[model samples]
Target: GAGVSQSPSNKVTEKGKDVELRCDPISGHTALYWYRQSLGQGLEFLIYFQGNSAPDKSGLPSDRFSAERTGGSVSTLTIQRTQQEDSAVYLCASSTRTITGAVEAFFGQGTRLTVV
Candidate 1:
């Protein structure tokens, strides 16, 4: 894809249902990130994967949330036994490091998940 892309732009599910959100990062970007934004809130980092390093999962809010990047291009975020509080817009971003070790990221329009 030319840019970061996410699937199911909008999703509505009953409380307790499970949902999976997908992200396709831009080609050649080795660093991928997942963040969650509650209504009227700022983005909260959920997880991050860079190259072959172990993913940084410290940002996940709970055991119910998990994410994985396969082949370092596609990523999926799974929310198991979703709760109403889990409703949010999930955002994905990808970036490549600069020679100076800075990161420049491109973000996808988030997948809005609503748990009713």
Candidate 2:
């Protein structure tokens, strides 16, 4: 894909259900990130993947939230036992280099998850 691509633009799940969101980053990009945004809140970093080594899972809010990147190309975010508080737009981004430098991250349209 030319930029980051996220699946199932919108999803509605029960409060206790589990949901999986997918992301496909730009080809050759080395950095992938997952973020969450609530109705009026700012984007919160969820996880980061750099190359093929271990991913930086520091930003995950709890044990229920997890993500993995495969082959340095695609990534998935899984939320277990979803809660109403989990209803938000999940964004995925990828950059050619680490975010600290001058490079800019290309973002996906985001997947909106609603827990009822």
Candidate 3:
């Protein structure tokens, strides 16, 4: 894709339901990451994937949250039994090399999830 893409820019779900957010990273990027940010809060790392290996899931709040990257590109974040506290914007980023000290990340617009 020309840039990182995310689906369902806005999601509103009832408590205890499930919601799935998707991301499509830029072409040929080898690293991908997921982060969550609450209203007026900083971004919180959720997971990181370097390639075909297992994603670093340490950032997931609990077993209720999970994500997977398929074919080293697209990723999906699934939140099970959503709660009001889970409301936030989910962001995805991809990294690529650049000039010395100039490497930066590209971010998607993000999925705004609201659990009522």
Which model scores highest in TM-score?
A: 1
Q: What tens-digit string does per-residue lDDT give for candidate 1 at 1-116? A: 89999998999999999999999999999889899999899999989888635358899999999888889789899999999999999999999977776488899999999999
For each candidate, give its TM-score against the true structure: 0.94, 0.93, 0.91
Give the alpha carbon lDDT tens digit for every residue of 60-107 in model 2: 999999888889888899999999999999999888874466388899
Which stretches in model 2 have alpha-carbon errors above 4 Å? 98-102
- lDDT of each residue in 22-85, candidate 3, tens digit only: 9998898778889999999999999988765544789999999988888987889999999999
Query: Which pairs in model 3 have colliding backbones?
Result: none
Error of 3 at 11 (Å): 0.4
For all candidates in order, the CA lDDT equals 0.90, 0.90, 0.88
lDDT of 2: 0.90
| Stronger candidate by lDDT (2 vs 3) | 2
Measure candidate 2: CA RMSD: 1.8
For all predictions, the C-alpha RMSD in Å is 1.2, 1.8, 2.2
Regarding TM-score, does 2 or 3 come out ahead? 2
